[model samples]
Target: MSTDPAEAAILSTLAARGPSKSISYAEAAKALAGNPPDDSWHKSMHPIRLAAQRLARAGQIEILRKGKPIDPDNLHGVLRLRLKEQPE
Candidate 1:
């Protein structure tokens, strides 16, 4: 869990969707911006991506491209976020 709103929203949204599902940057931005998100949600894209990077680095989540995990620093194009699968 994170105190930062972006990070927390990312986690909570993903958790709600379950581990096998992934969310687009826009979805996380919407989650942060609130339901029926306003145009201001558009402003949250970069910050949400950055927060995903931080969570990815900490092994709390994964940044995916082409449905495969990619290094957060190298993110590009359309991306999705999902919680890192816990080892059982």
Candidate 2:
């Protein structure tokens, strides 16, 4: 479990969606902010992105742009997150 709420929320949200599905930063932020999420949820976006960068670098998650995985360090524009595929 991550000490960071954003990291935990991101992981849990993606886990709930399963490996084949992905979610946007806003989605993760809303999840972190909780259901019926308020405007304050927007505040979580940067931290969510940061946690996503860390997770992607660690191979715990994959970052996508234009529906394809891209360099985690080059994150920009709209991005999505999904669990990294597991070997069969």
Candidate 3:
């Protein structure tokens, strides 16, 4: 339970997806912004991406791009957030 809408949304949705699945930052962004699953959701990506980096640093999640784990600090293009196998 975090005050950050992006953090909350990312953590909650990955939990909802269960341990084996992953969620895109875009998906978490939409859920956080209360935006419908449409083009408008794209607007939430930047914040959600930032939140993902923080979450990853906290060991709460893993940041990924193109099906591979990525350095949140080096995030460039598209990315995703998934619950870490052993989150802190």
Candidate 4:
């Protein structure tokens, strides 16, 4: 399915903060909606997580668990997204 909006939001949010930052999927959702988390915020997650998976596969980002990257396809429990490498 088309996950462009979420994909763009994820990358933009990360790029805007540079490689020193990371973003949770919920943050991606809120960033995409241009608002804070609320009753409607959960609605944004599915698309955002899917976009996370795609971005992870493209090697443009990483899916982190316990401060380290994990396999995007096999993820479980809480996670966050960060740039695959730090800025030098």
Best by lDDT: 1
Which is the leading candidate under TM-score?
1
lDDT of 2: 0.93
User: Which regions of candidate 3 are displaced past 4 Å?
Assistant: 35-39
Per-residue C-alpha lDDT of model 2 across residues 4-86, encoded as one tens digit per residue: 99999999999899868999999999999999899999999999999999999999899999899989899888789999998
Report model 4's TM-score to 2 decimal places.
0.84
Local accuracy of candidate 1 as per-residue lDDT tens digits, 1-88:
6899999999999999986899999999999999889999999998899999999999999999999999999989889999999899
RMSD of each: 0.7, 0.9, 2.2, 3.1
Q: After TM-score superposition, what is the CA distance of residue 29 in candidate 4 from its true location, in Å?
A: 0.4
Whole-model lDDT, candidate 3? 0.84
lDDT of 4 at 76: 91
RMSD of 2: 0.9
lDDT of 3 by residue, 1-88 (tens): 9998889999889999998688877679889778467677778887887889899999888887887888878987767778889735
Q: Estimate each model's TM-score.
A: 0.96, 0.94, 0.84, 0.84
Q: For candidate 4, what is the lDDT? A: 0.85
Selected candidate, larger TM-score, 1 vs 2: 1
